[model samples]
Target: MRRDKDSKAKADRHALLAAAALQDHLARRLRMPGGPAVQPSLEPGAPMTLAQHLNLIPRPPPLLSEDQWSEVHLRSRLRQDSANECVICKEEFQTGAQVLLSCSHTFHRHCLASFERYSRAKTCPLCRAAQYQKRPITDGQDLFRVKCATRIQAAWRGHAARRAYRELRRHNPPKDERLRKKWAAERLQEENDRLLSKMEDEVGDLDSLFAELDASVAKSREVCDAALRPLAARLQQGLLREAEAEAASGRAAGRLALVESDTVAPAVACSGQQHLALQLGRAGLGVSAGLGAVAGAGAAGAAGSGGGEGPAGRPASAAAVDWDAVVARARARGTQDCPICLGHISRRGNEGIAWLSCTHCFHIDCIMAFEAFELASGGTPCCPVCRSGYRRRCFT
Candidate 1:
């Protein structure tokens, strides 16, 4: 019985191996026709998948928001007038929509539609005022007020003239022609004097508006600086101290800590002893409002005189700066050679030269050479201390 079971097991194992070989032969036959080959049909510029095609084409810009579109339309109408010609299309204005500007220039409504659509800031074709609304540097209403006042005076004169004509007709009832003409001339002169007085008052109002605008912009910077000074000092003491310490370890030690010890260090001074502070508290008092200080510019007008021009009038604060001494000290403190020349300016050979107030001084011959080079480039030839652009009379 044991011999018979062993024979059956060996027969079952041989049958299983034969079946496996048959399956492998069938798989090989199926794969043999293709054998790892792949075919491709896509040509150049052919449409890809939906995602690829969408990515290949450039996307248009985002459309303007509803509020922005409305603003553009309003601004366009405000800037152009109904009767003016469009600069772009050179067309006449139409009734349903005429573009009008704040400057009183007018244009055809449709001429600027595309410009308003795509441009970030569409300007009036004539005056170049941008589409967005801006606060007037001076009162805008004052201009219209002046116009209205002039028109009122004109209307009053016209009415008075007609009354004078009627009165002459009533009294004389068609007398000699010379008498009627003489009466008309006398009435016109009387009307002119009254209109002139009204016009002068309107002019005075406009002047006051301009004065206020100047005062606002003039005081803004000073107020901002004064408010910021304390905060700036705190930041410099805390956040900037580490950076300053690191810089001092390097070559910049001489240029640090010039400020009043409590505030920021001055740029020109290296140490506390070298700092210079000059206070001019009288500047704002009795100041002139003009661009440059005019001693008493608006004395006749209602606008109060502006503050003095102050230290700003000086060229880069160099009028008060002692450049020659600063350069000598900087050279003495410097371990490196001068930035302009490779040679050490601290040494006797180069030390004889004095720097100008512009902080660009060099040897006399060096200035001449620099001037020649500047002339060749067609740039202003200024002194090295203040970089004051002056012509060099002699060439090296």
Candidate 2:
């Protein structure tokens, strides 16, 4: 009786298993595609809504073939003022799978897909237009690019910041006292070395400048010496010649004065005696015994006083010879003009022409040069033209 009960139980278990299998199959068929299949075990929740169903089971995005996408992109290129690159990536369009929005903007498909996945929106990535008609295309071209413009810029900026951080850490002083002192000493030494190098360079430039200036100064001095040598020599020669001329003139003037005094003394005395005899005869007085030895010139004077006679008031044919002698003496000292300067001697103001005892005349400035030369050379000043010893003539 126990065996019979066991067999009946096995049969009942088999029938229950078959019913469970059929129910599982029916449940699998009845559930919506991509919706939750497993029912809650503990408690039944609210029924699934249409929005929830659509959220779970999204529709597949549309795509175009390579030929169709190429034609559209070519058209965009031919259009005036069309963008040549994707704005999101900031990279030129490499022939690839891309998306064209309804707002007329285009982008790399992968880049836009990434943006949509993160933002969870159907809006245009560039224009922000909702309910956009996205036309995804397959261009069958090189599409290796993946980095977006923003991410690339962020990475570069991060790299720079990290590099700066590392440099700052290296430059900053450590906590250890010994190391900090060492760092400070090293920095100080480097700065001192740099300053020393700069100073040396400046000093070198200064030395070069000094050398250049020295060369210029030396060259100028040499040029001056060469140019002035001849002038100095000529001036010295002229000064010596002037001094010698003054000395020679002093000697000549002394000699001429001696000759005039010795040779002409007796003749001048005889003429003075003859003039005294003539004046006495005019007064009917006898000639003196002192004038007796001057009888020869007295007779001549008497003849001269007779005016065109020989002696004793007689008319003389030899009067022509006496007239010629007087004219010859006058001709020896002829001119009224100054000999030193060619200008006529006309007394003007306080500083006028000067006449000498020898009857030579000179302009003041014209004769001053020779006078000054003779004075400076320790010789007596003499007349410039005639080399005669003279004194200033007093008109009064």
Which candidate tops lDDT?
2
Off by over 4 Å in 2: 1-67, 70-159, 166-171, 243-396
RMSD of 1: 39.5
Off by over 4 Å in 1: 1-178, 218-223, 236-244, 253-396
Question: CA lDDT of 89 in candidate 1?
Answer: 68
- For model 2, residues 41-98, the per-residue Cα lDDT tens digits are 2111233333223333232233445675567567654652123567777776666567
The models' CA-based lDDT, in order, is 0.41, 0.49
Clash pairs for candidate 2: none
- The model with the greatest TM-score is 2
Model 1 lDDT-worst window of ten: 295-304
lDDT of 1: 0.41
Measured over all alpha carbons after superposition, the RMSD of each candidate to the real structure, in angstroms, is: 39.5, 31.9
